[model samples]
Target chain A: MSWLLDNFTLVTELALQHARLSAVPIVVGLLASISLGWLAHRVRAARLIVLTSFSLIFTVPSLALFVLLPLVLNTRVLDERNVIAAMSLYAIATMLRGAVDGFDHLSPGVTRSATALGYSPTGLFWKVQLPLAGPVLLANLRVVSASTVSLVSVGALIGKGGLGYLFTNGFQRNHPTEIVVGIVAVLLLALSFDVVLVLVGRAALPWIRNLGGTSPT
Target chain B: MIEFVGVTKTYDGGAPAVDNFSLRLAPRRITALVGSSGCGKTTLLRMINRMVDPTVGRVEIDGEDIAGRRPVGLRRGIGYVPQDSGLLPHRRVIDNISVVPLLNGATRAAARLRASELMAVVGLDPALAHRYPAQLSGGQRQRVAVARALAGNPNILLMDEPFGAVDPIVRADLQQETLRLQHELRKTIVLVTHDIDEAFLLGDEVVVLRPGAQVAQHGTPADILADPADSFVAAFIGSARGKRRLTISAQRSVDGADRVVVDAGGYPVGVIAAPEGRLPVADPTPRSRGAQVVG
Candidate 1:
């Protein structure tokens, strides 16, 4: 704790980097997941292929992936791109499942109603199907973001991770306080992102507030 | 001005869903298609808006073949009320009601105004406009669906089992509201239902269909009831249809009350005799609204 105060600037900077590193993968993964999910929903065989491939990709150990990504992408072992690339794979793996589940949870009769009402295909997809999918997608955002935050700490094993460096550094220098600070910081960051995602979801969809006023999470 | 001339539909080389169906529906009148499940009652209704196309014949609206019209354009002018209300659960009541008009190019303000007006017209309170469908009771949601269907002031309304989801009391209320709306608006309505009583009560003409979509009988309620075409029609009306077998005599009320008596299934049996032949109560069918009981 004393070392953390002594190097508060260092801690804050690394924490910011950690947040950025985690957030990038989540954003990239969300876009890719949405596209894949849409395709899977429309194509009969795409769901099977996507689910199987994503499951296999997710099973790659994080340490191995962090090391293996640099070789695959032709980057340096210490370059931050290596960590981001690996974390994005994890993020996409997580979010694809969430997106598929969200789509499945849609109200059954809404599609039939929209068609009978004469909604154009584009209009139905954007105005009705996508907006109605807000709750499920929001739930996915929280899960993917939190997991990404946790996994960002794992990158520190390679000396390129954000918060995980504090752990390795504190141990090398016999600074238990710094280690505690790093643990506390990562937990707090994950919690903050979860709350933020929830707030964003609520602001975008006010209709969800009246669903018994309970947490959809 | 809807005409179905020799319209037939079959799915995947199977038995015809609607076999050689032909009919003409006069403007501004309610025609009911009633039958058991798989009788193509729904298929017949769907053919109007081009949801299901005829395999062997063309359907015409106002002397124009609907096959030539774009489906989306044809559907926009025809209001549809599907079974189970089919309200969009994520949307508020007002947004659901206004969706059609908004899609049809009405400004948001104009659409919302029309939505509120329709809310009142469909017997829904204005306050419910901002509530999501999940927060509403089933009956309230059904009214919201009706409001949505009416938002565009459509010339034709296709109601597919519109009142099938509600309880008996709410069903009665909705039916009364529908009748009042029909009388006031005079829009052409095609109501599809399996309930024979609902068909008799609401339809200007009822078309009965068999399992294969063959027309069993087609006529007014009085026409079918007064003289059944065959035993199949008679049994379809009711198993204990004693009116065709027994003669009903008017007897004085035992309690000396001015009322008509009925047998078990609500058939009018006799009326209380007027004192000293002043005249028995004239009619048994309650002409007032919402007096509907099982036939």
Candidate 2:
């Protein structure tokens, strides 16, 4: 109890760090994925190839990805950037798949109608397609974000700062209280982020709630 | 006028969907392409807007070969309504209706205003402008789709089973809406449907396509009903003629002696003369009245 009081500020700082690390990757992955997914949808022949490649990337083990990042980026320097790069790679796979699924699931009639309406392909993507895909993409963001919170701990192995550092220090020092606190903090952070995403999804895309099973036509 | 000269479309390594199809569509008229599934009626319709390019021949719109124009540009001047209302679920009803005008470079505010006007034309309340597509009923969605198609005020409209997804009651309402729009807009419309009754009701000119995109018959509804080119057309249209004839005859009635025969409800249905005085049957054989009195 006395130790908890002594390290309260330190724990909070670690929690904040962990959150920032998770957030940066999720945002970057989401934006990149949406753009790439739209490009894949436009090019008819490339859809399967792009999806398959992303799926392959997702299959790679998370730890291995983190360990290998320093080599790929050509930096012996192991820091926050490496942590972000590894988590983002994992996030990209999930996000890309989500964006692709969202777009593909849209009614083909919408595309046909837009085309007939004289919408340039670009106009159609931004106005008709992306807005319709909003809810699904945001739901995907929640999943990827939660997973990212847990994965960032692996960055601690490279001496980066986050809750993972707390967990590592607890283990090295054999302090069960610190380990429990670190784990709890990560869970709370993930849960809070998820709730925020749901609220954002509802506010940004209210249509998803009313999208009943009966699709148009 | 729209003309298709020996248009043939063959999918890779597959049999031709449309083979040597040739026909002309008169301006400001409603022409229906009727056929069984896989008969390539849709393929032929797609050719007109260059959605599908013909493999063997040319499609001309207003006497100009459409081959030279970019497909995206060509599609802009043509309205297309699919079986599904195809409303973007996330977009408000007004935005969906404004798609064409927005695409054509109209400002957002102006496009929205036009959409509001079109909503009234399609019998939707102005209050519905802000509602998402998912919030509306099937009938309303279809009306919004029709409004969207009319956004650019195109010279031609293409419809493929536009009301096939709705309930019978809703389908009737939508059909009436289409007729009303056609009357007001006077745009050349090419509609494709497998339902013979729909073809008969909406088409100023009906072209019946047989298997492999063959044109079995092309004529006005009365002409085709009066004289079907072959057994295929006769069987197709003949089954519905009894009820159809009643509808036509009802329109021709001129007096108070003609009592409007309605169903259980008070809605004007058809005219039936008193049984005491009846026109003699041309044939002594029993004839079936194919006309069904739908409520």
Candidate 3:
């Protein structure tokens, strides 16, 4: 406990670094996934290929991806870009399936009705389809956010992990408190993210809040 | 008036859904295109708004070829009600109803005002305006659909089995409401249903279609019922069911003030007046009319 108080600024910096690392990949990956998901849905021939590729990427070990991406991108092993890029790949893979499911699970006839009611294709997607898919997308995003925060610590092995440094440093010095502090910080960050996502979801998707099955007419 | 100028629609790998079908639909009347599944009734309706364009030939609305119109612009000017109440589940009833009006460039307040009025027109309560679709009952959702269809105030309303999903009692009520609404609004309505009874009840002129979108028969309900064009029309209208054959079973008084009319299956369908001077319309039943005519 005294160690955490004494190294408070160091912990704060590491936590901030960890939050940034987790956040960038989530936001970037979400945008990419939405685009790819829409393409998968629109282009029937592309659906199987896109989904299979995303699933395959998720199967690669995270440590291997972290090592492999730097080589592919010609970046230094310790470059933060390597971690960001690799985490983004994992985020996209994790959220891609959810994006597809979100769009696929819309109640039947919704898009048909929107088209019939004079919605332009673009307008329908933004106003109706995207908004209705919000709940599912948010749920998957919460998952990605928590995992990314924890995963960023793996960067420590290659000298880039944010709070992950505490794990290796405390192990080397034989001090358990520093390791516990790192674990506690990551857990707090993930929990806060999950809490914030739930709040945003509730605010954004008001219709799903009090929904009951369609009442009998 | 709408005209299908030898329109034909063919998909990628099957027989043409609608093959060289042409028919002129009268203005301000209900024309029901009825057939069982795979009969292309829905495909025929969608061509009006360019949802599915004809592969060959063209559909014309008021002497203008619809193919020339932009699809979004064309659909905005048309009212469409699908089988399920296709209300947006995420939007409240008011927003769903106002969708077309808003698309037509009405201000938010103006569109919602129009939507509220349309809710009354479709027999929906104004109180349901703020409820989401899932919060409403099936009947209410359908009423919202009807109100939404009317939002743009389009002259032509296309219904693809509008009352198909509701219970029979609700369906009958909705059918009657459709009639009442037609009497008031007089919009040119094209309804599609697989049920011949519904077609006869609601359609001013019913077009019975066969599997390949062939026009098996088209005429007033009475004309088609009285003289079926062929065996296909007969079976479609259930002539073999003997439900339409009514007989005067018993006279109630000396003056023939009332008589019980029963169908072939012995179910009382209706009662009729048969005053003394006016001979009861000859019963089609083979049973001697005199024996049943107690008066």
Top candidate on TM-score is: 3
Pairs clashing within candidate 3:
A155-A161, A156-A161
**Docking category of candidate 1:** acceptable
- Report how far off residue B63 is in candidate 2 (Å): 1.7
* Pairs in clash, predicted candidate 1: A1-A177
Prediction 1 TM-score vs. true: 0.90
Tell me which residue pairs clash in candidate 2. B243-B290, B243-B291
lDDT of 1 by residue, B181-280 (tens): 8767777889999998898888877888887678888987777777777777777766346543433335446665545656655577566555654554
Local accuracy by lDDT, each model = 0.83, 0.81, 0.88
| Residue A166 CA displacement from its true place in model 3, Å | 1.5
TM-score of chain B of 3: 0.91
* Tens digits of lDDT, candidate 2, B24-53: 888887899999999999989888888889
**Which regions of candidate 2 are displaced past 4 Å?**
A35-63, A212-217, B239-295
Q: Model 3 — TM-score against the truth? A: 0.93
Q: List ranges where model 3 is wrong by over 4 Å.
A: A213-217, B251-256, B276-295
lDDT of 3 at A31: 93
**DockQ, 0 to 1 scale, candidate 3:** 0.63
What's the CA RMSD for each of the models? 4.4, 6.7, 6.1
Fnat for candidate 3 (0 to 1): 0.78
Candidate 3 per-residue C-alpha lDDT over B1-295 given as tens digits, one digit per residue, 9 for 90 to 100: 8999998899996799999999999788889999999999999999999989999999999999999999999999999999898989889999999899899999999999999899889888788888898888777788889989999999999999999998999899888888878777788899999999999888888999998789999998888989989989888888767788788886465556777788888888887877753545654322211122211
